[model samples]
Target: MQIYEGKTAFRGIAEGKIKVYRKDQQQIKREHAENTQEELLRFERAKGEALRQLTGLYEKALKEVGEANAAIFEVHQMMLEDPDYVESITNMIRTQKVNAAYAVASTGDNFSQMFSMMEDDYMRERAADIRDISERLVGILAGRTGSQMELTEPVILVADDLAPSETVQLDKDKVLAFVTVHGSSNSHTAILARTMNIPALFRVNIPLDDTVDGKEGIVDGYHGRIYLEPEPRVREELEARQAEERRKQELLWQLKGKENVTLDGRRIEIYANIGSFGDVAAVLQNDAGGIGLFRSEFLYLESEDYPSEEEQFQVYKKVAESMAGRKVIIRTLDIGADKQVGYFQMEPEENPALGYRAIRICLDRPEIFKTQLRAIYRASAYGTVSIMYPMIISVEEVDRIAEIVGEVQEELKQQQIPFGDVEQGIMIETPAAALISDLLAKKVDFFSIGTNDLVQYTLASDRQNPKLEQICDPHHPAILRLIRLIADNAHREGIWVGICGELGADLTLTETFLNMGIDELSVSPGLVLSVRKKVRETKLGEKYN
Candidate 1:
């Protein structure tokens, strides 16, 4: 009976109430398992149950999005099958009558220990996912389901936080909009919202409890604005905007395959930014010309240990094959302090953004780095696979990594491994990396300027941090200059340069980067066609080529 007003991202409205539930507790009958045989039997039962639950969830995911989209869940299944995830819990249960919380706590401790031994953030994050999943399962055993906000009526979801799985799985037809009191733009939940094209706002400054459930509310996710019950006139205006949004969607369909050349006949490479082999299908679905930047971090995020080179090869091969020889540029692990994966035991620092991450982690862990290199190299045989290193700072670091890459290629050749001759490159992210672009260009095959990090590094502000969020501007003169320098340097050396950051998809920045001489522009799959249209509006040769 009341109306709320706010900037709307997704169109439509629903109303619902909040339902909160606590974590579950699993019953561990320790005393009954005194004998070794009893202990083994108990362990087997627990493992089987966990595997069965994981399998069911994965199967459900496959049905929803198909095998390609379900690929991410495969990693969760692996975690359930992980010896540490299942066995450690079994052991704890057999040795003592620990509740699910205690057992999960014990397993979590051991998980942290194992992660500490790892050097790659990609691998380390997997450990964290395992712990997170395990703890979640333990909560299930303890009857601790997620806070189930009541949806007796279609209502906007109000929560302190939400899981990506929950957000994606929510009945979009019923849920109107989501407003979170706390979350990040990079969280899986946010990614899900973007994927679903849903209107969602994260890090809302106001508390959800401030507005009583069942009372009308409004959220404008794009502008980060909200309104309590508004005047009837305001509601009428919102409904009109929603209608206009529908109109735009209809018009956007005209952009498909319309050509991505700028107004002056300058062609630009518009590709998709993917996280896993699963996302390759989305790229094709969206008719993205190719894969721009494939974040290899997913391989680490869903794993307990370093992915075997052979394992990585299969994944890379699937993506390359799916792309059908279209360019697939893979960026190596970019894990760091703020992105702490349970497995990478980095000494927590006050400033994780500036601390050790990306190239820093790779150099410190050569063996792990080489394993990934070997995998990428092997996959290169299947299709056009170019490798890019992230978070490089100094020319010497580039030299060191390039030397290691050379060693990998030589080893592959000596071993007679089936691999393609892959191109090697570095991401121009750090201020140091940008300043030394000429020096780095002399060492690597190409460059991809990660403007997101470059902006943060140049401004000395952590984009991930709240206080500095306002300062993380990609258009800042310093950031623009750094990107221009790296692009100009790479082209001067006859090496190609592309941008795989958020800025690439930004329509406003398209002409700017094009003017800076970027050859490729990688962005989210949904934005590809639009960016391509923007490119076709520019004259490449006359402006910068």
Candidate 2:
């Protein structure tokens, strides 16, 4: 028996035969074609076929996953049709006097390498997308089908890594779990696996030899362990753990529709944070009270250029309408730092975290900011929609945002476009914002403390630095006191305060937050019921009052 340890992306248990996925990079010969015209024609035909396949994949994904995820296929289709990408392949073929496949392979290598070397995480993932699309075109030109894994039976899939396209195209029923030798928790594969509720382990050091193929394996996603040829006793224990998890999930479903109130009769709202429209389904499935944080940056990150007002409006409207009458607090474009956009034309900085980002970028580039404000206001007419600005460190920033919003409203009115009265708010992330919470609270409808940045800035510890992990404690006395101070200041001004960061999802802090009079706790959809359950079981002590 062989045992391997790794990091878990999702918690579940599954035992099945292991199937090692091997995507062999095809080598294209540098053969000169008789006619350059013929090579260009072949490339066009292959490109058209790739587009057709991508469109079909888009529809399939839309049905299987939600729109936000299915949007990847649309992105893939756009990439395949990108004029620059097409020009690169064609120019290579004509200039180099090589076959169409050779041109595609060479261009793919260059583009993929460039993307992989980018500083941003989102842009780095695009490297995989470029490779996926290039492989499709190359396959078509070479008279062979693209890389598709066919499963004859259910098995645990093990791979070095999986591209977003490849991960989405898997036969879900036949793939019980995913084990990748190299991948990050933020990778597309991890995101899709969590969305699909599939067990996954990444960063595992496993033998890559084909000799391990078809071997019986047990995956314990909860503990991040893989057991190969498990002993009878270990197998039984795993079965029991799986059964227990199933029971717990069933029990959680029973908590749905129940108010998130403590035994002491104090009610707190449990909401979900969503990145895109696709995440709305999970929010509803988990019975969250409302969306506390609707990250508007995904639209910006996914687009090749600035997303149009109409495009942003339609998406915002869909999210609002889908939530019924529940409130949706959409945070305006929090880009830069770890999340960077190519067209934003931002300069490289030694410390991007503290540099031009979020509201700073929006305020400097009012044209871009105003377009988004118009979209939010227009969507508000469909249902309740509120706007929140990120990285606000002063009352003046809030004042500036309010001014732009007023401009957008006036323009919409003159155009005879209808909109609703949307509430405005700011994130309390920096120490400066929290310190002057009383003054800032009076300027906005509510306060949502973004602890992810709050903790990092407070302790002067980089959140991404593993060595400083201990100093980045969310439950530290200083952090808790800041939360208390913000809550108190906001309450004094008749404004509610909520935590919408990783700390909000921490079960250990649920009661403490309730005692602190936190109006709401916003976490991922998967943690809604669990947090609600914790709220329902707790009784506020006299010390809290």
Candidate 3:
């Protein structure tokens, strides 16, 4: 028996036979081509075929997973068709006078190395994507069919690492769990596993050999361990854990569509915080009241260049129409800080978390801000769409945001573009905003306290730093006091205040939020019903009443 420990991507328990996934490493051999032109033609043909394969994969992933996961293939397709990639491969073929396969391999190696050496973690991960696409093209040129796994029964899949394309192509039913030797919790594979609700353990030192294949294995996602040929006692415990998880899921399902009201009859809105339109399905499945925080930064982050107003409009419109009149509070571009965009040309910051980001970036780059504002305004015509600005510290910032929104509305009116009256709000994240809540509350329709930043800034501790976690308490007296102040001030001004941060989902604080008269709590979709259940069980205006 062998035991391995790793990090959990999702919490679950499963026992199955091990299925070692060996990626097809297509060998590129040097071959002398009589004509360079012929080699270029072959490269073009292979590129076209690779694109067709990617498109097929995209459609399959779209059907199986959601659009967000399927977008991986679309990115792969873009990489294959990128002018820089094409020029590099062609240049090598023309300059070296070698076959298409060798040229592709050489160019891919150089590009992948360049990406691997980058300081940014995001750029470093792109190395894997480059290799995946390059191998696909090389396989096509070599007349080698791509590898496919045909599993006879359910198994725990073991791999060194899984590319996004390979991960999406997996049969969800056949793959009971995932154990990988090489992968980050933030990787695409991890994201897919979470989306599929599968047990996954990454960075485990699991041997990928024929001797280990088909071995009975138990994956404890909660503990991030893989047990090979576990004893009866261990197996029984795992079975019980699995049963408990199943029961909890069933209970959450029953809570769906139930009113989020306290025992004392105080109603609180339980909405979902979504990164993109693709998350709408999960929101509906979980029966959220509405989308409270539609993170608009994803639109900017996912794009190769500045997203045009029309491009942004199409996505915002789709999300609004799909919500079908459910209130959607779309937060304006909150880029920088932790989330950075490549094309934005932002300078290196000594302190990015406190530097020019969110509202600061939007205010400075009004063109980009207005483009998104225009899209939001246009989408409002389809359904309920309200805009929220993040990282506001002063009333002047809110006034500036209002001014830009007004300008967008006027431009739409002049263009004869159909748009609905949209509500404007701001995120009270900084201590300054909380201290001046009364003055700021009158400037916006509502206030959504981003407690993630609020706690970090209030306590003078970096929330991302694990060592400082003890100090970064969301339930701290100061944090709770600030939330109460914001709620009180917003209520006095006839506006509602919500929490759209991680703190809102903390079950322990749900009753406290209710007692403090918080109007809404926006959390991840999976937590909506659970939080709703908490709301129903709590007595209003009580501490353990």
TM-score for each of the candidates: 0.76, 0.90, 0.87
Model 1 C-alpha lDDT per residue in residues 231-289, reported as the tens digit of each score: 57766766677677668666666777676777767777888888777677779877788
- Scored by CA lDDT, what does every candidate get? 0.69, 0.89, 0.87
TM-score of 1: 0.76
Instruction: Write one digit per residue (lDDT tens) for candidate 2, span 1-545.
Output: 88999989888999999999988768889989789999999999998888888888877776777665666777787778778888998998888888999999999999999988976556677888898899888888878874478888999999988877788788899999999998767776787888898999998999877667889999999899999888999999999999998898899999998998899898998999998898898999999999999999989877878999999999999999999989999999999988777678899887888999999999999999999999999999999998999999988898988888889999999999999988888899999999999999899999999999999999898776645778888888889999999999999999989999999989888888888889999999999999998999999974343
Between candidates 1 and 2, which one is better according to TM-score? 2
Measured by C-alpha RMSD in angstroms, how accurate is candidate 1? 6.1
Report the number of the highest-TM-score candidate: 2
CA shift of 340, model 2, Å: 3.8
Model 1 weakest lDDT span, ten residues long: 14-23
Clashing residue pairs, backbone N/CA/C < 3 A, model 2? none
Which is the leading candidate under lDDT?
Answer: 2
lDDT per residue (tens digit) for residues 1-545 in model 3: 77999989888898989999997777678877789999999999999999998889888877766666666787788789878989999998888889999989988899899988965555567888998899888889878775466677899999998888788777778999999998777677788888888889998988889867889999999899999999999999999989998998899899977899888888899999987777999899999999999988877766778989899899999999999999999999898876777689899887788998999999998998999998889999999999899999998888888888889888989999998878888899999999999999888899999999999899998775545768888879999998888898999999999999999999988888888889999999988999999999987754322
Ranking of candidates on TM-score, top first: 2, 3, 1
